[model samples]
Target: MERELKLTVATERWNSAEEWKELKGYAKTFMLLMLLSMTFVILIGIGSYMRHEISAKQTTYGLATVDIKQSALQGMLAEELPYYASNQKLDTFSLSSLGLWLLEKVTNVSLLDPASLVASEMLYSSVEEQSTLIHGGEGSDPAIAPQDDKNMSLAPIDDEYLDELLAEVGNDNSSEPDEVPVAPEQEEEPAQPQGVESAAKPVAFIYHTHNRESWNSETSNDDAQSTKNNITLVGQRLAEELEKHGLGAMVSDTDYPTAVPDYEWEYSYKYSRKTVKEAIASNDELQYVFDLHRDSQARKYTTAEINGESYAQVYFIIGQRNPNWKENEAFALKIHEKLEEQYPGLSRGIWGKNANSGNAEYNQTLSSQSVLIEVGGIDNTLEESYRTAKALADVIAQIHQSEG
Candidate 1:
């Protein structure tokens, strides 16, 4: 077993001296590439194993480390993104950087687009309208006449919407809560003898249902005002004009709306009704009660150019639900007819709305001579509304002069 034959055949076929010199360079380069490839594979495997281990540990122990790390990463991105965007040139490919760049572009585009501004305005107006519809605090009178989507003409009012506004009425109609009666329906009254007038006595009582309705003429051509400085001032001017025409007028500046615990529109008329009753009962000379209001329509709908002067268009609203609506209707027709004859385009035609359609009686049941007058629109300026009021005073005075 220890005997071994010694062989002496030496062979250099595998690596001859000349071949080794030439092959060494290629062999060295191949070995280096292989080493690098193996090292990369090994590192990838290690990383995968580490992730698995971390996931397993989290599953077993319910550790918050991953969540905390995610939060930290998001916070870091949020905090660093602006700095990187402002300071550094964002030429590198990164997901967070791309997102930030896109957001900035979108912001810039929104600022440049005029439609975006219009969209924002529409949104704001819609929000305001819905809020008023819900709260019953329509200081701008938007619900009084909504925009007509179809024809863009003067839109008829929604009565059901107006009916909901009655929530503002107080418990003054009856001592018992249930005793308040709906305005009773009666036969239309015959026209009374015309030309009934008393000398040197106030015959007209003018008041505002929405005294807070204002105009934004100082700021913009559009109507966006809602301060106390609007419609109430027009009423004052109208009262003055009435006196000049020999028609004594009592104008009320009562902010009865402030007494409302909430935006109670129903109570608005009821509260004003109390004021009306007190006026009529206290003064036997008061013959006509006018509930002056501002129309919420657009400028074109409420404005009229008459004899090179601008005036707000006027409308006479008749409540057919009241028992004495015929009397009110007759008087309103007379006024409307008279105005049409003199002022022409200043009149916007008469509108009749019943309880089935809007506020029903609209406190018209309280008196036979009650009339609801809408003067101008939201876009109408104080000067325009005042001019119409002056013209109105003239018309009423002429009617009064014709009285017996």
Candidate 2:
């Protein structure tokens, strides 16, 4: 019986070992399948992510290219488009065609108005008349005497009075007789009217601060030098124009002994004030003073072509910081009106009445006729600015002659 029990135990052990091996094989297959499934999902996710990234990059590039193209188109429109259109005596082929083209091209830019541009040009043509009416009544000087039409009369002198005068002249001539004394022919010299001297007030004085040390503070040394050269050339031109109109003008540099800031905003008021005070101390028959400066606007120079020559745009800046602001503004308005009359669109406009913010005095307190004129930006060449100055001087000369 013991032998039989041992055989049964051995058979049971062999069956148990076979069942364990089968379970191990099934577990291994399940794990292998799970690993393969996970690998497939990871590969799909990576592919989807790469595709999405590439699409996003392409969209950004496309938008950037569109922006660049639009910018180029706008630049071409501003710079090149206007030259192709005719300005004088606009017709269907010129005005209408150009207007339609511009309208179509700029339709997407809703801010621009075609009518406004045309209106501005028309209004600019009538600036002189508008300015005169705006300032006061009548277009001529009011100080002259009125014509006397109703006081015309004719009176005859007495013949007896003339004979008596002749008899007295004969007696006087006889009384002056000596031993063969011959009377010299008495010639009456013409009498000149009072207050009719040849000397007249100057039109304007060109003033500037040549601060070499502080030139590079905001603009470069080259810019400052260009400004100086332009001013000098303009001064010469102005002098010539004044001479042509029989007016005496002197262009002198304003020397400030103390070192100060180059920029108008950074300049010390006390220093400027002191310098101006000293300059006026030696004021030898100076009538008008012009402080010349350059504007800070764009990186590229701004230039205008007038009468086949290029010129820079000028801005008339009046300072309300002085006690004589009203008088200064009046003087500036006179010049402004005259400029618009002679040359259209030469002046930018009159600015600086509101002194509450960012108002620099610019030494206008020295005289009622003082004004600060900004010629052009740093990008403008010296020749362009000089041309503008010459044009300004001509306007001033015309005004001065009219005043005289």
Candidate 3:
């Protein structure tokens, strides 16, 4: 198709300069309002962030209380879920952390990482599973389930004995002078402090699931703890002494605080299991693994007078929850025999506990050399505990040397 046309025309008569000027002024005012709003929003964000940081200053149990939550161990490989780690800390100045923190403040719910949430659900689920096994499983005895809530008693509650201990150790501090019980040795000068050449291959690994378990010597408060001076330091001392004696050793002072129930201790072993596995995985030479703990008994039951020196009594507790408990029992028996030979009466007989009474297997099914060693009690002094550690180190050194 084809067409052609041409025309000339002037501007419209409705265009007024005064109207244009008014519209331009309105645009500027609008821009100013927008700028003020932005500034107010920024100030609010900063204030919220500052408030959050101030409130979250206090320390937390494993994995901070980020409302969103999820929180391991084993021998048949390992459990499906990992133990809840309470050591996670939030970055104070991180933008993402700030925004999330604000969200948590605004909303009642928490926001946790996917993995952590999953792990937490799994851990609680496993607890329920263990409870079921202890209760209604085939071959489960009614005697084991006498108390409904006793399914996972962290510490043994022997009513009669515990009452006796409580009565003896009242809340107040002892009035008697705190003295260091000395060793007036009547035997060969406590086997000349033995030393071993430094080796790259680590032979032993020591850790405390409940590192806050303090003693009277360290904190002047038996049960109360100043994390600085607790059984954790004892474990480090043991590691240092062992390393000197040629048993190249490592010690972990990871504190697994009670993030759940106020006094529950069952989660401790699972926490230590993760630490031990990581340690052993990195160093294939780690053979001897110990989950050191302080007993909760009275002073008389925990202190041992041997060779004129005070040594905290050591007890071997084996868990029956795992299928490979026989291996753990065998090692405990061997140690018990050796201890008898070296320091008779110093070793308490092997105590077998299950989930029904105490933490079962205690991560023992992970390896043959795994053992839970309770050194001393809440009333025992740190000095006595250290002495026991030395004696135990000597026994382990002897065993390691024999193998070498």
Per-candidate Cα RMSD to the true structure, in Å, reads: 22.5, 30.2, 24.2
Compose the digit string of candidate 3's lDDT tens values, residues 121-149.
33123322222111121112222221211
* Candidate 1 local Cα displacement, residue 298, angstroms: 0.8
What is the overall TM-score of model 2 with all chains considered together? 0.43
Highest TM-score: which candidate? 1
Question: What is candidate 1's TM-score against the reference?
Answer: 0.51
- Candidate with more favorable, higher lDDT: 1 or 3: 1
- 225-273, model 1: which lDDT tens digit per residue? 4556767677778778888887777777777656555746444665676
Sorted by lDDT (best first), the order is 1, 3, 2
Model 3 stretches astray by more than 4 angstroms: 1-199, 220-222, 258-266
Error of 1 at 181 (Å): 15
**Model 1: which ten-residue window has the lowest total lDDT?**
129-138
lDDT by candidate, in order shown: 0.60, 0.48, 0.58
TM-score for all predictions?
Answer: 0.51, 0.43, 0.50
**Per-residue lDDT value at 70 in model 1:** 42
